[model samples]
Target: MSNSFSDMLKKNFNIDLNKQQKAAVSHKDGPAITLAVPGAGKTTVLICRTANLILNHNISPDNILSITFSKASARDMKERFNKVFGDFIKYDVKFSTIHSFAYFVINEYARLKGINFKLIEGNNTSLNKVRILKTIFHDVNGGYVNDDKLEELLNTIGYVKNKMIDISDYSSYTVPQIKNFNIIFNKYEEYKQRNNLIDFDDMLTLTLRILKSNPYLLDKYRNKYRYIQVDEGQDTSKIQNEIVKLLCANNNNLFVVADDDQSIYGFRGASPEDLLKFEQNYPTAKTFYMEENFRSTKNIVSVCNSFIKSNKYRYDKNLFTRNENKRPVTIVKTRDEHKQYEYIIKKLKQSDDLSDSAILYRNNLSFISIAEKLDKSNISFYVRDSKLHFFKHWVVNDIVNFLKLALNNNDVQAFENIYYKMKGYLSKAALRYVKEQDNSISVFDRLTTYPDFRSFQIKNISILKRDFKKLVKKRPFEAIRFIENSLEYGKHLKEYCKKTSFSYEGTKTILSHLKTIASECNSIIGFLTRLDELQALIKNSTAKKNNTVTLSTIHSSKGLEFKNVFMIDLIDGEFPSLGSIEAYEFGQVEDLEEERRLFYVGMTRAKESLDLLAINEKNEEKVFISRFINELEYIMKENDEIPSEFSAWMKIGMIINHKRFGIGRIMDIDGDIITIKFKSIGIKQLSLNLCIEKDLLKAANS
Candidate 1:
């Protein structure tokens, strides 16, 4: 049967299946899981397996069900399956997303039970989930919530539901804001129930409930989908796994295809632990590893396979590729982010096709400066995930309003915008009183004339008025500092964060980036104009979808391939993120592991060339390269059969061990000359390449 299937594949599609892929495709019974590595052709194996089940095993097409995590994946699978079979099969197999399948079960059950529920999410609903959440937030917290906070809240809710955590145990999770998070959670659920509405998460939870409650419906599905296959199994949440489990209980034929190394969505409640524990769930299940990468070069595959070994909680498998080793993986270090941008621009110009290159980053903000640089260089590019939230942040608005009030004290609108955000404890009533006064006088002065004001309030108002006068004479950058430090606006933000449970560090980071932008502007007008120009550039870049280089966050770049991949901002705090490092320090290793997986995913995206870029300094402060990069270096060095002549891992401030001089710290590196400060031998200058070739120096263990 396998030989015949191979012949058919070769004759029709001109493709040959590897041994592991063939094994995965031929496993037609019982329970099995395939650990499909990146670019291992899991989707092709899945389609072939589906066909194998039908043509060889004589299974009915309607009895087979294939589920993926996304609509895009499901659509791609269906289209590819149709193209592969091309009317050779009589019936179409059922291909659906877990959500779509759940909705099908829900609609069937709802119709039978005569239950009506309006979806509060998606375009069909009159009720807006975000609006309801915002109102609930404002009612409870008594302040405006930014898009970031709102997004965090929505994700927390989804995480809770997807993880099947009880509302009673909501506090156990590190949910955002709302000390009474359970209250908000319950309120949202209650509001939906009372209004006869449901959300996207409810689709899963309700389907699970219906399945568990109605044995007849459960048996019907279990019998219908005699053979069930799930794609991207590593990204399946607990609830999703449970639904698949119950449906596959009767026939015991379940095929889950996943790569735990690429499981980077733990924040969304996706757990690779379930994938690892597949045997525990199905004792007879066999696991196959499709570790042959068909996308990246052998060098990329080798380096990334070694790099991902640092992660502790993954299936032990090496990803190998047959593609030519076109170039060794390059590590480019620059003086700062600007130099990094210059390096990227130079490379893009040298490339024959911009569409084959990509600039990937760990965060969305990393693309802003690079996007500006690309636009200035007249290099067309497309941002996969462009977020203008930074420009639209309330902090940006408050800073602008502060500048406006400084330029014109009589600007009533600007005063109203920032009065409450400042150190002055201005109330709604006080603001109303000021609005009724003449617009010619300073609103701060008008605030002092309020009859109900306390003595301290009046004094603070006077001080604020004086601060605005001082601010008028300062440059844009200095004005930002004055507002933050001298005027106590930063303190106000800190206090607001404390009260609302918002992220003060994230808010401060936004202000810091704003300050950086301000440093480039001579005046407030210039700063404002720069902001508008950058935002417009980002917006316009999205339209240049074809014949342009791609800029994307690592998360968005999943399942994408590029000829040349440049991962920028590979610094400790920026790439691994301070939060992930802190979590690792606190004994939570999962976050750091996920960060490694994200980097690994970015690396494997390159088909021919990969460059990892880091900055030696950012904003005049010394910053180290990402520890992930350091780990990759160590892996490469350990795996090398013969010592390389040059050391790519050497950087300033890195501690090293010398065979003769004992322990030393790298003082500087100029061309081939390396100056090291040894503990026992004082300072010594050595040839960097000679040290590596002779194995005279090694990286000191942290």
Candidate 2:
């Protein structure tokens, strides 16, 4: 605290630093970590701290380095800093993304060493990283690499490099379709070295190697940047942290702003564990907490604070707000997915302004149905990540081709698309032979005439012909079911997921959504037409550029806020994800905690009103609310009368005993309304609230 700097901050920026923020900004020496809660204005604190160093301590602007998570953020920081001190300061401060800084270091080191390198990654690069990886994948596995497998391979390789995993341990990491992934990794690295090529991940590894091997350069960098500030430290990978550690090794003037509770990027190899263990790395480091959230209402802050506490791996901190609670956090339960959409549509219709409202979901597929409904209702919306990959998915294509073949058995194009994906086991040679046959004959019937066909293949081809004859008479909905079940395409998808390391549940969810879309069509033509319309609608929705309601995945909604937020599809399998739940059950809770963090992030995005939407049934099957919701409710102690295991016991068709109505069989359950057929009182619908309030219901066996 210098009054001159404080006065300048108030005069120039019109900002008053909170006590914690002031402390964080004034601490100009030693390593420090600030645990900033969501919406706590850490960016402000970081900017002010950088200013504090320049103004009060008289630190050189050239000697200070500020690092952010993304290029946009770095640009925003620079703009904001210029707004605050552009007139007062003559020199410019350096602000960059860690990747950008690493590239700079690599460039400088290469210039000094006279080593020319070509970047094989990024949009500007001449060499395509994915194409190279695909070639390596084909060479290693001798199979056609699909998009999903290629994405998994790319992520796995990036994860290994970002985590700084040793070459010997690459085999332990599971990369589907390629058993000896190290061979591919080694070959890729060797190719890069031979060709003087480098990818994005190599930026860090190369920079680290240059710094470690060349002490003169390491000392040069350490002295060049005396004070370093890092934003979003929780999202920093281990290698990134190590690089920062080397940069600040001599000065130890590292200041990191992070919130471990918000660490949700574990899949990208971000190590919140490194953040949690900041003390071990710098024993003298001081930790500070900025737990005041300025962006949410008190109720929203309170519930999210309680919800995130369920994760045991996070640093303990409670987020509080001074803003009044405009409304209690709402838990809206709909009878089914369609009803959920109706509820959202009704709410949006009643709203005066759509720009301040948002509908957030865990998965991208969650938006397809609602987006369609919104368009049909003439409700405008902007999608944050408007990827219509569902319509273009391989599964969707396979199902469409199957239906096309069923509609016209002589469709050689359709046969060519799905022959390898089905149980017919037709080879390329057999396909070529089929093309040469009579155009009037069905592809399946023509397959039996191939001379190389086995007796079993002939039998399968005959069965497939019979199935297609039966499939032609079904509606589009039934046709999709036939393709999934009767045609055994679902079995193929399961194997595909296994071989590609793709998410089986997510694939099934996509198929389930496709079936939902198909249920509206009578003929296959109508279904195909509807798919085209939806794809076009989704693509065009992003181009509207209006201030309409936002449909965003929770991940995209981070660092954004809305006056009202509706988190839809808040069910067990959709939000927490089946993989997270299964891993939690097996005592591996890292994934589960990340899911919890995602839920917390979505909830805290609301400033005034927050609604958690769930459906009791989807596609005529029972579904439970997300455990995160129940955990938050339990934490708030809002439904004390309702037992902790209420979700487990409230099943459809379960026999129950009512204290006043005697033994009964549950007939149907929708939301919280339980319909039961009592032996003494006939069928009666009772609210769960009434049951819990009066202690009237119990499991008969219990």
Candidate 3:
């Protein structure tokens, strides 16, 4: 059966199953198996392995299950299988999300145990918990947390059920400390159960609840899933992995694929540590090494190898490639953040892929300077995620136009355009809340209504409310006539015409797109609802190609690939993240490793090039260089691996002096930005030639 399966794969993929792939495909119906550190062909192998089973091994595709962390990746697998098998395959391939798989278990098992199985949409987010914590638990009870602390808490909840960290640690304290956290954590369950709402987290939690309660459901599913494959194995949380183990109980019938170094979703409870434990759980978990370099240039891969090799207990692989290193991956050390932005723009202004090119950074804060730089350069860029949510942004024109129209009445076309623009993010309930004039449902209201505001609902409501609110303010059929010629709508249309800002115009353009959309939608309301779904899918489809260089946080950069990745702020405080000085009693050593993994993520994003950048303040000068550059320096000095110009030019520093700011030295020298240290302000960017003169380097050269 395995041989016939292998033969079919050979006819389709043009490659027979290698020893490693054969083992993965032919594994006896066993509990769990890990395919460790395999290469570029892992996905292809998984697909073929499945095809082999369905075609020859006689396992019904319906009985086989596969899970992945992303819908996009799942879609990718579906396409891959379609391409190879001609789409006529009839096996029931249950390639769903882990949470979805778990939900199926509870729905099946809980019912047999006389437990009423309830259906919950995992994506529905409720703001009740955040609001409760803020008003009752956090402030009225304790106090409020700033954005960073809030982000940490959100990241923590995702981590807890995974058992990456224990919630019990916070149990010893009470009032406003760890005890307060426990109190909130305890209430989370109460809130979810009471609302009967499931967030993304509740799926895993409830699945575990059902499993513990019903052994019968467990047996049914264990036998139901004859073969299971998990992709992004590095990200499987503890509860998730345990569920898989239960379903595959004592059968080596499960295969897992992931790269330990690429495990960037740890903030979301994905622990790579479990990948390390596959051997203890499944003895024949053949660790295959796919060392062929497919994604990066040799130079980029080499530099990355040095960095990740620092991690212990890693599977050693021969990750060599026939692809030559086009250029030694360079570090454009910046003297400061501003300089980093300026230099990146100057260098990339003429690059072929500048529109496709990206400037990756440690945080969104770095985007401010770069966005300004691109704006000044007249370069246009759309943030990968925020591109379509044009209405959500504080576009002065959109706000003024919509507010004016609503204040007047249902002005012709004005309401539709605004509704069209907004349909991208607003949900139906929110639209209803606003239409009902639920002054209670502010942006704060909509945001908090669900764990994550389900996208479809928001648009459905925002568009309707936007219209109803206009009518509510205006009133009467006679008022409609008045609104038709109302000076307010005319003024809004006039203002829309008068607005010269490109961004504002972009909003207008979307309205025109919406008008066409509205034609199909028929009513202002129907078109708006469908328009919401269309705009969101378009936004998520792909990164827009525009001349402006993009700068985004690494977290936002996930599931995205770029041509050039510039990692700025590679210094200790910024990258490893100094974090809330409060959260770290000693300092974030873990945060630093996370930063290192972040850097790894940024580096891996590139197919051709990667730039490691950093900045610092010293002697009133803004000094910037790759901290990795220093590590590179250490390696070069130790091994005599330094390139001739690199040793001298890499060490080169210059001075920029302002009469008021005093002397500052160059910490980095990217094209336009020069890092300078001034006597009073310490280190910073002195916009090249803005209020500065170069000195130290000229003298040194002479």
Task: Give the TM-scores of the predictions, in the order they appear.
Answer: 0.86, 0.86, 0.64
RMSD of 1: 6.6
lDDT per residue (tens digit) for residues 474-585 in model 1 = 8888999899888789999999988866667667657766766776778888888988988887887776466799999998888889999999989987789888898899
Every candidate's lDDT: 0.84, 0.83, 0.56
Q: Please report how far candidate 3 places residue 27 from its true position, in Å.
A: 4.4
Tell me which of candidates 1 and 3 scores higher on TM-score: 1
lDDT of 2 by residue, 74-103 (tens): 998898888887887778787899989989
Q: Compared to the true structure, candidate 2 yields what TM-score?
A: 0.86
What TM-score should be assigned to candidate 1?
0.86
Task: Report lDDT (Cα) of residue 700, candidate 2.
Answer: 95
Off by over 4 Å in 3: 1-39, 87-92, 109-149, 164-166, 171-179, 385-550, 556-560, 579-591, 617-626, 635-702
Total clashing pairs for each candidate: 0, 0, 39
Please tell me which model should have the higher lDDT, number 2 or number 3: 2
Task: Estimate, for each residue in 60-107, the C-alpha lDDT of model 3 and write its tens digit.
Answer: 887889898877778888887877775658544656788777677666
